[model samples]
Target: MISWLMLAQAAALGIAGLVVAIAGLARRPFGDLALFAAIGAFATLVVQIVASIIAPIAGAGPTGDLLEYWTYLLSAILIPPAAVLWALVDKKGQWSTLIVGVGILACAVMVYRMHQIWFVQIA
Candidate 1:
């Protein structure tokens, strides 16, 4: 069965990314939006961490570490805030735009990977 928690995290990140992009376009203050993304990612991270801790018990180790499998969770947890921080620290428009693009790309890859995980059924 597909894991609902894992899917939930992906959905939340996708939504958060959309919200962040909209916030970017609207030219609004990003503090609250950043906080929302952080909280969503943090909550998702907690689920992933818990899953990692229980993986051996869940018998996924013959496959791989749950942590290793959850690259999306890791990216979701780190990338947005990192992009915002880069936005704050960088003086160059080129670098700031590049970082934002990278962050968006990471999230896009995450969405694709998530669809792979959820869309395929191992019958």
Candidate 2:
């Protein structure tokens, strides 16, 4: 993975997590901003997946286990949409906001791990 791209994605995920978490704490319902942030977080994962594929062809592949990295990539890609769906299904209370918050946090952690795997051999 590219270093800058990884950092940007991690930061975006963290920001999204913080936003949703704050909304949950404030007892705010899911809204456009939250939805956009969730989409943005998910889109970041999609970009990461594309980068993962293109990087090797561009001679920038990670030094870690490709299978493991791809597994994490795929899983990370699923999180946002799944959380959004769950939130939509459970329209009552702050559960939706909470789920999005937790999902973004999980994405942040997963992205950090992906970065680690990418740079493991170099370090």
Candidate 3:
């Protein structure tokens, strides 16, 4: 499951990069990219949340390490919207790139954290 999350994170990063690249090269607002990343982040997090809810309900374990996963998941879930909202503060879209760019980087770190929590048994 964590591996799947990692893959999704990687895909999100790629889509993020596509948004960044397209925005940069085309001289277009990064808002489009931010929107793409935000939507993707929300969808991916929904899958994760549903899985987290069901995994334990199906008799997996007490919490199934919810404490371990929550920080990473929550950060990933919040990043896109936060970035998008922050992007809204600026009409020129400079902030959009900042938010989405950092969001992508954050996703990479979250992927690592997920592996650390699930496989390495780290808190």
Candidate 4:
């Protein structure tokens, strides 16, 4: 994986988490702005996924636990869309905010795991 790209995505996930959590606290539904931000974060994840795939083919797999890395990768890739779908299903409801907030939290954790996996061998 590209360390810089992973870092960027992790930062994006943190920001998105803050945005969604604040919206939830404000008792507001997840709005277009939050959705767009989530999409941006997802895009970053997608790029990271591609990089991870390429890295292994280029003989650059991380020396850390492969299963753990893959678990985080899969979770990171799946969370956003599930949250977005939930939000869409309850567009006018406060539940959307909580759902998105949870999504953000999940992403944040996943990012941390990826970072750990990426650097564990080096450390």
lDDT of 2 at 38: 85
List the global CA lDDT of all models: 0.55, 0.84, 0.65, 0.80
Q: Candidate 1: where is the Cα deviation over 4 Å?
A: 61-76, 90-123
In the range 1-123, model 3's lDDT, one tens digit per residue, is 546665666666756755664565565676565677667766777787676677666764332366767777877788767776776776585456665666766665675666556555633
Residue-pair clashes, model 4:
0
21-114 in candidate 4: lDDT tens per residue?
7888788867876687678767877887888889989987887887888888888888888888989999888778778777877887787778
Instruction: List candidate 3 segments past 4 Å from native.
Output: 14-27, 59-65
lDDT of 2 by residue, 1-123 (tens): 589889878987998898897887787887776678789888889888888888899987788888888898899889889988888888686678878888888899899889988877553
Candidate that scores best on lDDT: 2
Per-prediction TM-score = 0.60, 0.92, 0.72, 0.87
Give the lDDT of residue 73 in candidate 2.
Answer: 84
Off by over 4 Å in 2: none
Instruction: Encode model 1's per-residue lDDT on 1-123: one tens digit a residue.
Output: 236655666666666666666666555544555555655555656666566557557664323333434665566557756776776676334344344444654664564464454345232
Q: Against the true structure, whose TM-score is highest?
A: 2
Predict model 3's lDDT versus the native: 0.65
